[model samples]
Target: MIRAAAKNHKDVLVVVDSQDYPRLLEFLQGNQDDQEFRMMLAWKAFQHSGLYDCAVSEWLWKQPTVGGEYPLSFAVPLSLKSSLRYGENPHQTAAVYVDKRLSEVNAGGIASAIQHHGKEMSFNNYLDADAAWNCVRDFNNPTCVIVKHTNPCGVASRDDIIEAYRLAVKADPVSAFLGYTASTIVDPVGGVGGIWLIWDPTQVSVSAHIANSQLIQATVKRENFKEWVLAAVYASPNPGIRQNLWNDLENTSSLMVRPWLIAGTILPIS
Candidate 1:
């Protein structure tokens, strides 16, 4: 029996009641390519981390398979962590965490991602991006979203990915030019010309590029369900930023004032 309750069954795989740390590591190292081996590895990882034992599981429903579907489907478990985003306000702070398993079968291939650049994402960035991407990702076409503060200044869905860019530009060209453009989370490609950013608190100017307008290629609305959200605590204090600061702040929400914005959707005033 594949016991998911790690806290309850911590000793199930234990040899002679020992924690078996080495054995655990060995097991993971071995049979890495085997589908069944991967499943076991996933369970063991969850058990060791206490996610299945101490943490709550999400998206825990069963589904049918293809061709009138057999009852057997994957019970994949995915995890999520909510980090501190400077807070609801720069002064106020908050956090939200979840353990959502995206699948239950074929465990060996799962892995987490690491950010190489940009400012740290905040609670609002997650929420707004979740909402923003959810709206555009299903288009079976490429789309672009310009988010100011946390609200959607521009969201365009079309057959041509460029058209999506044009729509976003048309919605709020001024804000779109300054705001962040997030792709999808599952995107193998890290949106360079158009993507999210991290606000450097020390420097006043946010990191960006002038040629981002040129690299856009393809026109798609097929919706791959990948996306990202972006925001800077504040714009760069550079002369270029200074010119747009008022408009950026006025057009976009204030991280200091408004902790988050759900682009393309209504946000309740706190």
Candidate 2:
């Protein structure tokens, strides 16, 4: 109506009753060029034809059931866990929350993952890690699953962790760089360019214990700390230096570590 009035270069008048007059007046405030017509045409028509009363009576008769009759009409209980570093992108803000009922039944999922190493986990990292972890956990043998944008790009199972990794990478070599790997063992010597590591600490128990001590010492000795942007620890470390390791890494490195505790086990990785 406003556009038509502007195009025709003429004033437009709107007719409304007392009930709708205020709203119409507010809408046409700056645009009004003529006086408004006030009339209760609708009310007079309904009074004579009884259309409004019949419609109201029909609506009341067909009213839907509520509360007790429809148990699905209930609110879910949720508790805010923590704020994520950012959402899928840096400009957006996001947070993690847990459903009270679901968390009680499945307590070992991503909602309980701790940050033990790099920067705070981003929303995308949590999603990718969750996907990779779920796939790797399903296999009994040594398995490697690489996830990118919440989809598995490469997945393979073998007796040997290294062979499994190689086979997984062979699935899609090009996408391997832009993905996060969930595996029993990740070769640290491999190019760490775009590949993010989500390693199981239990798989490298012996070496992880030694690496824990070495990592602390390396942090102390090296003047330049390398940043592993996408690396996450999804398994618990040795109990002896758990606190010490977390403190040292927090103090020394620019990298973020996510310490996950699953089924009463603390998974610490750097």
Query: On residues 1-270, what C-alpha lDDT tens digit does candidate 1 reach at each position?
Result: 334433334333422224556755777577543444344544565555544433332223222332233324333334445455446555556664443433244221212233467656665656666666656656666788777666777887788888888778888856764433443221112111122332323333322311121111111122353232233222222444344534544554432342332221111212
- Residue 33 in candidate 2, Cα distance off native in Å: 53
Indicate the worst ten consecutive residues by lDDT in candidate 1. 210-219
Error of 2 at 212 (Å): 26
lDDT of 2: 0.53
Q: Per-residue alpha-carbon lDDT of model 2 for 147-265, expressed as tens digits?
A: 77889999999999999998998898667863334422321211121212233233321112213321312111112543222213322355554566456546545543533221212
Which ranges in model 2 have alpha carbons more than 4 Å from their true place?
1-71, 100-108, 137-140, 178-270
TM-score of model 1 vs. true structure: 0.36
Clash totals for all candidate models: 32, 18
lDDT of 1 at 108: 19
TM-score of each: 0.36, 0.37
